[model samples]
Target chain A: MSKDNKEELKNDTIKENQEEIKESETLTEEVLEDIVEDEVSELEEAQNTAKEFENKYLRVSAEMQNMQRRSNEERLTLVKYRSQDLAKKIIPSLDNLERALAVEGITEEVKKGLEMVQESLVSALKDEGIEEVPVTTFDHNFHMAVQTIPADDEHPADSIVQVFQKGYKLHERLLRPAMVVVAQA
Target chain B: MSKDNKEELKNDTIKENQEEIKESETLTEEVLEDIVEDEVSELEEAQNTAKEFENKYLRVSAEMQNMQRRSNEERLTLVKYRSQDLAKKIIPSLDNLERALAVEGITEEVKKGLEMVQESLVSALKDEGIEEVPVTTFDHNFHMAVQTIPADDEHPADSIVQVFQKGYKLHERLLRPAMVVVAQA
Candidate 1:
């Protein structure tokens, strides 16, 4: 009888230990599930942060490009009009020279002075990148026909006959077109 | 005697407890000191970050101001030169009319045409902020004295004798000075 009682007590002890082991396994499963969920949320948060950084980079780059383009356009326009004030100052000198030459039957000394004045004008204009437009032949791009003159036997048709106003070019672009009379067939 | 021994043992136990409490207190103090250091570092980091932001703000603002100044200057220059090409275009018409009137005595019809042409020239120039500098008096700022002419009784000493060149103004600014002969006593 005593041996049977001892055996029963040992069996009870084993049963209680098995129950404790089962409870620990369930707790471990719960902890593993929580860890996996936490990892997924952390990954999502890191991805969101990277996306925000990329957006900021793109915005800044676009702004920088706009600033550069605006400055470049302004620089180009400034160069285009660089000779305005100087041209204003020099036109009166040209008019004075013209009036002096227009006096009927100019003296030899006055003619010499006029030549010098023309030379000075040419040099001053050249220094400022001012060039005369070509007008020996008719060119549609750089001449405006105010009149059409008939072609003679010696003169070729479509040739420029007279230049009413001299045209100027600044930096290879036409500042003004030559007002011209062209010969026609 | 036994009571005295018990009291001594009690005192030993109390001493041990006191030492343990002191050790725990020291550990807590060390932890608090580390936390304070971390807080100080965080405060310094925040201050440095704020200063960096301020520096960037100031640099961007200064650049914006420089760009603004340059843009205004360019716009003003564009306005000044806007009429230069147009003026060059119509100058020949005026020159042609002027040449026609220069012939030996003018008829009434010729005089009327000349007056009309002159009026048109004046209006065109005035519309573009262009004006002629006065030639009745000589001024060093707007006149170049080319010679000293002998004055008659009608003119005063040190006065302008004649204007060789007609001066011009663009928006109250001197474009050219009149070339003149001055009289002296």
Candidate 2:
């Protein structure tokens, strides 16, 4: 009941409360540190996983682009050669006309018909992406002259003088090799 | 300097050493818990990202298969109709053979030549996948009636009385519809 006793009790209560507060603070600090560490690791893992997915996505996208490009090439090829069937169908008509020209035809009407047929054949060949191979000189890329012979001084060697069998081209590709007699050097 | 003082100093040293050990243990436990949590979260996130990528991979693979299937179907259709060009080229030869057959009063040599021509035409048609449309009573699907007339009272209606133009099928598809005369009721 004295002043000293009361002061002593107050000090005791304050010290006990301070210890409890310190323990609670330590526990809270431990839990907070654990949470912070877990979150940091989770974030690091998420970042790594995202990077890996980005790589995979890039690879897949590149593959898709390549496939699309290939498909486009195939489609272009189809369209470019779409009329080849019809052109092939008409070639025999040209052959028959050539035969008629070779035959002995005395009539004027037949001659006119042959000329008309030849013109029409040329038009058809032009229409169907087929044209005569341009091989005035002996270049090896487009023309294949099967035969070679020695040339005179006036005519230059490696020049195309005689064409035995005509060369045919279909859409920038060699359909048949030209059978020609070329000058020998 | 006294024995009591020496003993008290020894006790204080022991207490301080034990406190240091306890502090170290608590710190170590905190560090270990943090590291474990970090490692676990890192693994979990990596696994989740891997799952996402796998699903994407499967989807792309399915798309690739579909594209290939579609392209293959287109290629097969192209192959089935590959001979159309050649058949068209040979059609004129067939017409000429027909004209030769119609010619009358031929010598034996001429007859033999005509037979040879006919044989060649037949063989060519066979090789080119060209077949005449089979006709019996003639359903409308394969035949077009160019003319119609009343049948004999005994005959059934829609009977094929005559075939004017031969119908032809090229690889199971009608190239030209057959012209016919049908009997009407």
In TM-score terms, which candidate is top? 2
Model 2 chain A lowest lDDT segment of ten: A105-114
Evaluate model 2 with DockQ and give the value.
0.09
Q: Report the C-alpha lDDT of model 2 over A51-123, residue by residue, as the tens digit.
A: 6776776687678779878977886777566545545444444555555555553244444444554565566
- Per-candidate clashes come to 0, 0
TM-score of chain A, model number 2: 0.76
Model 1 is docked with a DockQ of 0.04
Question: Among these predicted structures, which one has the highest DockQ?
Answer: 2
TM-scores for all candidates: the values are 0.50, 0.62
Off by over 4 Å in 2: A1-13, A82-127, A131-135, A153-156, B1-64, B82-131, B149-163, B183-185
The 10 consecutive residues of candidate 1 chain A with the worst lDDT sum are: A84-93
Q: Show the lowest summed lDDT stretch of 10 residues, model 1 chain B.
A: B86-95
Model 2: which docking level applies? incorrect
lDDT value, residue A47 of candidate 1: 50
> Chain B of candidate 1 versus the native chain B: what TM-score?
0.74
Itemize residue pairs with steric clashes in candidate 2: none
